[model samples]
Target: MNGALLTTWRLWDKIYYRCTRLCYVDQQNNNIFRVVIKKYGGKPLRSEQEVVVSPGDYYVKLHIHNCQLAHRLAGMTGEMRLGLAALKEVKTSLPALAKFVAEHPNADKITGVVGTTILYRGAQPLGFFVRDIDSPLVRWYKTFFFKLILSLCHPEGVARIYQKSDKLVAKRVFMSKRDLLERYLDDQPQT
Candidate 1:
């Protein structure tokens, strides 16, 4: 990743940590958190007042603020793809999911929400929606034509496309060995 992307990822990491801590610490009440990015001296990024983080001038520093209980819940509502088919089947094995996530640096950075939901009123499958459609596309094609096609397709087609795209994303995100273990664990029946 480029410096700008790395910085953004790091900032997101800090936000995730703060949000999780807030949620864990105060489970009783509603918690909200604001993530702010501002140039130095309250100037815009294009302004001279902005502080450049690197000599190469890839990134700028920004101000961040959080409430007592940061909104970790906001993080918990996005699409995630687990490599293990079995785990994908169960859908509720959070510990297994967490363990799978812990194996990767970026994956571990993710908290709150994991896993994509296949919308359905009952047994009949309905559709799937990308939770964070604006989120950075981890894959090349996902950012370009493929994602556009998937988005514009019919509901049933969209679901199929999501399934295929998720498999590719899961492979990219998870370690093969760890993912296999998770898949095995997912296959086992819950007690």
Candidate 2:
């Protein structure tokens, strides 16, 4: 993002954070996730950890810090390096998130964690369950939003989106609390 765009995005991000009640799991600007407690909408979801999430159930909703992520990924070359860095960020984030959930006052009310992304491949092996977005409007909005972020963040910008348009569709990913705690809490150092 350029100077003006960057400023605008930062302003908007502030407003979005307030509006969504987003909480920073890691308490750092470079942290990958900002989350909010939200009630699940749409159809029921069965997570890999065997938790069933029904309508109105609460879960931690994740939002990627796109601008921070773009900054972290800036100047990197090669798709492999970028992919590996992103995976590392995800892995690095899990411990903090697990600690947050474990200590939350409402942790008992939370069914699990949920996020939507175009980058759904390889998530299953990491304990996430992928599903099609139930709402067409949501799907379209997420596609547009993520693509815009990608264009702004990617080194090649819009070209990369066009070249990989086929795989850019948005999907929902879910991870049960059981999976999150089992995979991250005991082994991960408290952050």
Candidate 3:
């Protein structure tokens, strides 16, 4: 029974990856948006809205941050399931976020999530939290040791920790950004 469940999960995982990768974007400047017409073996899948991004105009979507704590703390089954989804989302998103930040280094007016913290940059610092850096050890970790270890492991990345901050600098930024995000969502036209 356990083996059957494992096999089913693996099959779903394969299907999920294949279905998700159906859409591809071409970055070449000369190409006028090429879309591949793939034929599925059986029933056709419904297509979502198509988006074309121009240079310097890209979308940065912010999903709710759900760490292991968030999943563990969820009391309801639905919440737990959503948290699990969030876990997967964060994993897939972090790499894409890193790639975007790398590709668009000088991107003017680049958008980002107002609520969350940025945990890594392309390999200077190892990890960071935005809320509180009251501890000297955390400061040391963010400043020195983390980067050293990261450089030893992988030098190409500039890892930066943007965890929640109680520090004077981040406090003001987070408060204002979060408020702006909330206001924007509030002002959206109702359906």
**RMSD (Å) of each candidate, 1 decimal:** 19.1, 2.0, 20.2
Cα error of candidate 3 at position 114, Å: 6.5
Which candidate gets the maximum lDDT versus the true structure? 2
Worst 10 residues of 1 by lDDT: 120-129
Backbone clashes counted, model 2: 0
Query: How many clashes does each candidate structure show, in the order listed?
Result: 1, 0, 18
For residues 84-173, write the lDDT of model 1, one tens digit per residue.
322233243333433333443444223222112222111112111123222355334444443443333223335656665553331111
Q: Report the alpha-carbon TM-score of model 2 versus the true structure.
A: 0.91
Model 3 lDDT, full chain set:
0.30
| Model 1: how far residue 99 lies from native, Å | 6.9
Shift of residue 129 alpha carbon in model 3, Å: 1.0
Most TM-score-accurate candidate: 2
